[model samples]
Target: MGSPCLKTVGAPSLEELRNSPAFPKSEDFMKGPIAVIECIEEIPCNPCETSCRKGAIVIGDPITNLPRIDFEKCIGCGICVAACPGLAIYIKDYTYSDEEARISFPYEYLPLPQKGDVVQLIGRTGEMVCSGTVIGMQNSRQNDRTTIVTVAYPKNFFDEVISMKRIKNKS
Candidate 1:
């Protein structure tokens, strides 16, 4: 029997992401909280659009279309972050503080970090960029098992951080 072929996936480059229509602009990021759809592929999925109760996420016509987020209508609830099977949705709140920002991402793993716990912020390419504090975590039944973890970091590193890793204690 032949083994299944595996394809290696690399993080999207900044230039590539900036060129995408789905990526929010600098002005959009500065305007309160908003949804950042990182989904780059054209897959037949619409859970993000359906999960949003505020009707902010729009995937019109074909289900394979990339999600279009109406920033003005988005409430930054982070519900869509957990609902996305691809883990492509994220919520960012630049208004958290003048020096800091909050990012909510879908997490599904053991030893989940709690509020106030210090964690290592990882970028899209799985590289550690900086340290952040866990500000909040939500794992309600409505989330269907995906836990959403919110981390706060310096506003300067907002564009670099996408996820977090729990810090381990040295023996």
Candidate 2:
């Protein structure tokens, strides 16, 4: 069989990080499994490349290909959430509990909700399923400017929710 596209290399070298590895099939890390994207578009993004405290994510020489996040070093601190422009980067902790998990993502809406606010959680396709609670909101110095909001949802909905919107009332 062909080699596993990307294997865990202990503390890759600068050259190794600068060079791109034959990335795993996007489908593998794309939707099902919990993941964090360093950046979605090619554009010009190094914040994720440099913002990583553990050197988990890498953007190679061309800086156009999608970043590769080393699942090993990720600490789930949600730092990269502030660095991503497409608001694609997220901290997905599928191990929040034996039965539940937390999905932290970027929130850029007006009248930003505070921690403990009950909100209707929507899926990537904008379908609202269950409710989630805001557990944390960080806009500290290290985050630059983007507000990182951590919400806790049912373990079953972990893969379903990508972006969330406030639920409006019926008139």
Best by lDDT: 1
TM-score for model 2?
0.72
Residue 148 CA displacement from its true place in model 2, Å:
1.0
TM-score of every candidate: 0.88, 0.72
Q: Candidate 2 on 1-171: residue-level lDDT in tens?
A: 332222333222223323534222335333332345623335766677777788877877887766887765666677767776667667776667666667777877766778999778775445686788888888888776677777877888755666568645446
Per-residue alpha-carbon lDDT of model 1 for 47-162, expressed as tens digits?
88888999988887888897787777888788888888888878888889989999999888877888999899998778899998899999999998888998889998989888
Residue 66 CA displacement from its true place in model 1, Å = 1.2
Candidate 2 vs. truth: CA RMSD?
9.7
lDDT, each prediction: 0.82, 0.64
Residue 117, model 1: lDDT of 90
Question: Could you tell me which 10 consecutive residues in candidate 2 have the lowest summed lDDT?
Answer: 4-13
Total clashes for model 1: 0
Q: Give residue 157's error in model 2 in angstroms.
A: 1.0
